[model samples]
Structures are given as C-alpha cells and as structure tokens.
Target: MSHVHRDRKKLLTRVRRIGGQVAALERALQGEADCSDVLVQIAAAKGAMQALMIEVLKGHLNEHVVAGKTEAVRAREAEAIMQLLGRYAR
Candidate 1:
C-alpha cells in the first residue's frame, strides 16, 4: 500500500488542522481584524500548508523513490519529484 494510505488518519488530522487555520483566517478577514492579526493568520495558514506538503513529499520519497525496486524506477520517481518541486517553488 502507499505511504499515504498507510498514514491516512495522521494526514487527515493534519489536513483538518490546516482547514481550521484557513477558516480562522477567513473569519479574521470578515471581522476586519487588525492588519498584523490578519498577517499572522495568513502566516499560520501558509505554514500549515507547507508542513503538510513536506510531510507528503517525504513519504513519497521514502516509499516510492528511495525504496524503488530498480535503479531506473528510482531515477524516474526522483525526476518526477524534482519536476514537482520545481513547479511548487514557482
């Protein structure tokens, strides 16, 4: 099974927390929160998203790329991950 499937509960929990952060951010905006407070909310939501991405990326690398059965397969997986990272960076 895939790492994501294996860790579905844990990942879902993180996702839920991130969702809460986003909701809070929306509420802050609707309430006309101070600029600094809004900025902090945005930062919190962004950080949560980054953390989730990193966790998934790490799992993919460990399960799909590093543990691949063949060198060619591993190379392909690594290349795909690199491409994904490039797009994510932009």
Candidate 2:
C-alpha cells in the first residue's frame, strides 16, 4: 500500500477541497446564486470526486492487483477492479 501511503496527505487534501466545494455549492443554493455559477461549482465537485476515485483505483491496482499473495488472488482482484471500472466508464 505504499502508493496510497505516499499520497495519503495529497489525497486527504483533495478530499478536503472537494468538501469545501460542496459547502460552497450549499451556500450558493441557499443564496440563490446564478444558475451557471452553481452548475460550475457542481462540476468542480464532481471532477474532484472522480480524481479521488482514480487515485484510489491506482493504489488498489498497484497494491492488490500487481502484488497479491497469489496469481489467482491477483487475477480476482484485477477482474473485480476492471468490472467496477467498466461500470464507471459508462
């Protein structure tokens, strides 16, 4: 899990930023901000979340798919991740 450990702080920071974006979205909704501005903020939050997912997926692939206890386990892990990615892709 070194991939994840090495980037823990960075990932946490990203998550925090996403949280801030969500809070901003909430405030904008409360204050009745312009539709375009609110949509942009929503897009920002969605992009941040997608980035986080990519990071975690990379770590999982490196740690579990590439370094599992056995070939069978690794294949299973990789297949599971691939299935999730397939769904995400759509």
Candidate closest to the true structure, highest lDDT: 1
Give, for candidate 2, the lowest lDDT window spanning 10 residues.
Answer: 1-10
Would you give me the overall lDDT of model 1?
0.94
Give residue 47's lDDT in candidate 1 (0 to 100): 92
TM-score of 1: 0.96
What clash count goes with each model? Answer: 0, 0
lDDT of 2 by residue, 1-90 (tens): 377788989999999999999999999999979999999999999999999998889888888988899999999998999899899989
Q: Considering only N, C-alpha and C atoms within 3 Å, which residue pairs clash in candidate 1? A: none
lDDT of each: 0.94, 0.93
What digit string (tens of lDDT, one per residue) describes model 1 on residues 39-86? 999999999989999999999999989899999999999999999999
